[model samples]
Target: MDINRVSARNVHQAHYELIVIGSGFGSTFFLDEALKHITGRALVIEWGDYQPWAWQVEAQSNSPIAPESTYKNSGNKPWNTTIALGGGTNCWYAQTPRLHPNDFKTRALYGVGHDWPLGYDDLEPYYCRAEQIMSISGDPDIGKVLPRSQPYPQPPHKGTSVDALMKAAMPDHHFICPTARPRMATANRSACCANARCSQCPVNAKFTAENGFPSLFSHPKVDVCLKSEVRTLEYSGNQISGATIASEGGEYKVFGDVFVLGANAIQSPAILLRSDIDYGQTGRGLHEQVGANVEVFLEGLKSLDGSTITTGYNYYFADGDFRRNRASCLVSFENRWWPFGLRKERGRWDEMLSLSVVVEDLPNPDNRVTIDPQSGQAVVDYRGESSYAKAGIEHVFDNLDKLLAPLPVESINSRIWRPTESHVQGTLRMGIKDDGSVIDQNMLHHRMRNLVVVGTSSFPSCSPAAPSLTAAALSIRAAELLYS
Candidate 1:
């Protein structure tokens, strides 16, 4: 696709009811819900192309394609989210886990992050709605754990050699069972038709923002500007007027009645910083929970030699630290290394299935994100620890080490790596008061009335489980705030 740019004035002088920025999961879910209530002209601006890029194919060549059909991030250019259509849903692991109610009330019960503005009960309907949209599949009855939605769209895929081996080795530690239902990829249909390890869904099984959002573009009222980038927000008075856009064709401006920032956690904060919009705590005190993988290769146990490795036991998800429990340290006997070589590490097919490891990370403010003056990009620096994260780490490795203790692949090695945040939250956090947060409980920007933020960034503290399901759920609630 060719790049083009237009002025905000030319694009929206007539005024659009809403303009959604970034086409990731947050925008997709929210926009879909918004259309249900507010019927007006909408505009969606995306920087990346809607189609798959060269890098995605390149990455797949390196590994057995991820069965869950997740977006493969190749650190080639600026982070790519689907710009042409579906956003990152074009590729995202379909693992959907809800926030245990304990996680939402953490701040009130435990002194971790602030308690969520809304509780699990308030968001339950949205969770149900999101589940239907994503077509989730899982067994929610794991003893005391509450299942957020109904049974997944499909039964959990069969476990692989690693799954069987872990069960044989340890009956004590329990890993959280992942849902096998398809992630919502498109709106009309909710499930994907693909293999367990298939990362790219063949039948729109997984729902991505693109799947839901393109409908908005098709609406006579909504106009989607592809490859158009928002560089700044043009505000007048307390309300937002429009936005300034930059693209290959140059600079332009766009006008909208309301502005919605769904640019993911990192980019949203970065955009605010670049726009010279500071809510005082805008970029300060950012938190990205860091994680590390610990590998255990069983001695004399060549049981891991298999083509399709699926099914996992994710024990150690809950050590009962409610405040920090949102950041569950997961231990799974799945493929150890990401199919593709991480960083600069070179690998072959054999390297992809070499061993399996579990990861535990602490949510630290030190491991936060800040703007770099030199490069002017958001940079992450992770360095924080919690007793729960540390304990979770220890528990996972201990369990793994014990399981493989008597096997030929006996050596157990644990190394700490810099944290990678999945359930990224808290940049534009919710709080009881204005000074304490970027947005109020309603997800509306505290300072800006016409702006709302949706996604993990709104999370004050990430829970221990998968945030995608919850993120989808909350955004549905956010859409309700606008539509309902």
Candidate 2:
């Protein structure tokens, strides 16, 4: 199969009903809904070539093109993403958890960051739709914390001994991790083997754009152009007129009645900035939780028996009165066994557990993405992580031992700081007005009515959870609200 296929056709360039800028969760999920109802032509512009799952596995990389070349930055913080046809879907671990209800109302409930213009209920139905499309495996009991409309398409994954202990102790807060990794073998993929190289799943068990939404791209109404990077958007009055695209052949334009920017937090805003369409805090409020890794050494207990890598979560620390003062945290119990996962002692080889403390940070307008004048690529100035998140990590490091007091006695290792969460967000923030936001609650550009900006770029808050599910849900809702 040709890995780098580009359709030379003008895309019927004269007119397209919709022109989407990325093939990530935001674009694909939106097309999933739009194709079902809208009868017009849709064009997807992907910056990277379509490398199949088999090719990706054989290559041992998501893309032949490196992610670093897509942007220019001098900051020490690493920006992680796959710049390919499926975007981050090719490399993400697929830990699909919906944001807690309070995550929508940070200002109202926790008296901190701005609340989301839309709430959990607004996206709840679309969340179910996205989860169904991805065949998400999750514990239904998680509905206790975040309300659900339907049962998960797949059953909950098995838990490790550590997960079992935590759940037995805190039934209300601890639950099987909601994931896009299949629990059982499905027609499209096999069950997860738990090797933990989830970035590039060796067994092809995780939900990727290749397996999960294959039909969405191939739909008769949709047309895709691979290795075409959109540099800027052109608009007049209050509508998006066209986009300047850089492709293998040369630079060109693609015209559409509606445009959706799904090129992630950094690139999306950079595209807008390059177009000279800066407004509504175009490249501001960039934020994401940079959390800590907590490795627990157990005495007699053994772990790593789960069906998936991450088995369960302790949400007790994820939300509480402490959120008012410190960032909220979602603690994930990693059910992974490896050479590094083992205890050094011969007798206690399996007596170890790994936990990831993911914290929620308030948006800092100072941390943002801008277009570098020299290269015209994304320049992410993102050093402004909140003290709220830092305090949240400290809280976990200080009290995790006590929280695990019910379990076997052992050493709780020092918290190791992470360089990046791999989730970039809030660059093109959404709000009720156009002054301090790019898009509205419905994902529509506040001033450019026909232009919709989807994905984490429109996120108002940086929740600790992975952004894929919420991104998918928002896209689906955007299509539904616009077309239906």
Identify the candidate with maximal lDDT: 2
- How well is each residue in 1-484 modelled by candidate 1, as lDDT tens digits? 2223333445744568888897777777787778777667778787654564333445552123221122222231122223345455655656666666766776567666567787877887787788777655554443245545445554454454555555456544433345423433334444543343334544444554434343455665566676666777877667888787776667777777878898767667777777777674664444444455544444323333422233354543543653344345544444434432322323322222233332323334454556667655666553455565566555555565454443445344445544343445567777666655788777888778889888777777766565677777777887787655
Worst 10-residue lDDT window for candidate 1 reads: 67-76
Candidate 2, poorest ten consecutive residues by summed lDDT: 1-10
**Runs of candidate 1 exceeding 4 Å displacement:** 1-12, 52-85, 160-176, 179-205, 210-216, 297-310, 313-317, 321-327, 335-391, 399-424
How many backbone clashes are present in model 2?
Answer: 0
lDDT of 2 by residue, 20-92 (tens): 8988888878877877776688888888888888888888899988767777765778777778888888899
Model 2's alpha-carbon lDDT is: 0.84
lDDT, candidate 1, residue 141? 41
Error of 2 at 283 (Å): 1.1
Once model 2 is optimally superposed onto the true structure by TM-score, how far is the C-alpha of residue 142 displaced, in angstroms?
Answer: 1.2
- Local error of candidate 1 at residue 451 (angstroms): 0.9
Per-prediction count of colliding residue pairs? 58, 0
Per-candidate Cα lDDT values, in order, are 0.57, 0.84
Stretches > 4 Å off in candidate 2: 1-9, 337-340
